[model samples]
Target: MTLKSPISIYDAQGLAFGILMASLGVTFLKAAALVTGQTAGAAVLLSYLLPLDFGVFFVLISLPFFWLSWVRRSASFTLRTITAVVGISVVSPLLGAFIRFETLPPFLAAILAGACSGVGLIALFRHGASAGGLGILALIVEERTGFRTGWFQMCFDAVIFALALLVLPLDGVLYSCIGAMVLNAIIGWNFRVAQAMPAQQVG
Candidate 1:
């Protein structure tokens, strides 16, 4: 699509598919007892500590970032992000019911989860939306500083992994690192911040 083109029904379908793939990645991580990074990681960590589902924590934690998104991006972008966040929050939980991984290896789960999430994020970026949380920050930083969004997220993932250590097994955290690397590498190498979307209606 050209920079001048408007968002169409096809774009909506793409956004929906992106959300589904991202939610599937989350399901993989949850099944393997591994948390990658970003708001999804925080939601998973919180879900482990509390008595709620990942969906509840995912939406609740992402709420504050909406304001940040509004200030940094556009209203449309912010709305798209909110919708995407809610969509993942709703879909991810239901996935456990339908698609259960009886004995998923954490190492394998990490690779699959990272691949799914990376491609899914590319789709969202193309549509001028994100999964909320640090994703918004990553985009803003990239736009302003010419920094790669994936690298920016990798820095944040460091802190999340450190915290994960306290809550998760050492081996699990190590495997999670592999997933985070794969996720960031895909984004850093593929999605350039400047050409992420069109200036017109990508958001």
Candidate 2:
């Protein structure tokens, strides 16, 4: 494929995949009463604290980080992250309105949401893009420290979940932490698998 055409196609697919992942991530957060880290976690915390739409809050919180990504990372990475961010910002509320689970248990919700979010995250990373929250921060940390970003991300998520406990009930906080753990574990496994895969296979 020509450079222009291939890049265009990749962007389109990445956008779709990013939206799906982010939406599922949000769903998991809502269901399990969990938070990730950085912007998205901030958004979730703010939404719980204040009366605000999660999607709007998420985009507003991510703007500064988007600017930071542009300065710190490649233009392509910035562009891809921006696309994913916008897509998630737009789709999350719509998904929220359409999908309702009145009876699902919290643990099951956590497991399913974590799995879906993980799959979505793997798709975004494979496409040279991201879901643009803790994921971006993790990527940056991994590039700088050579320590596994997944573990770093988990630490941040744990802190956020801990703070969340102060705001929410103890049980809710516990479940949320569990959900975060599952999500981060999936992220760690996916990253290692990606690293293990041959360059030719990944390409």
TM-score of 2: 0.84
- Model 1: lDDT equals 0.88
In order of appearance, the predictions have TM-scores of 0.94, 0.84
Off by over 4 Å in 1: 1-7, 201-203
Give lDDT tens digits, candidate 1, residues 1-203. 22323557977987998899899989899899899899889999999899999999999999999998876677778888988999999999899779976588899999999999999998898887899999998888888788999999999999999999999999999999999999999999999967767574233
Candidate 2 residue lDDT tens string, 1-203: 11122456765785687578768778767755666555677777888888887777887877777666666665566676777777777777777778787776777776666677667666666666666766776776776676665677778876777677778888766766666677678878767533632232211
Best lDDT goes to which candidate?
Answer: 1
Which candidate number maximizes TM-score?
Answer: 1
How far residue 104's Cα lies from its native spot in candidate 1, in Å, is 1.4
- Global lDDT of each model? 0.88, 0.68
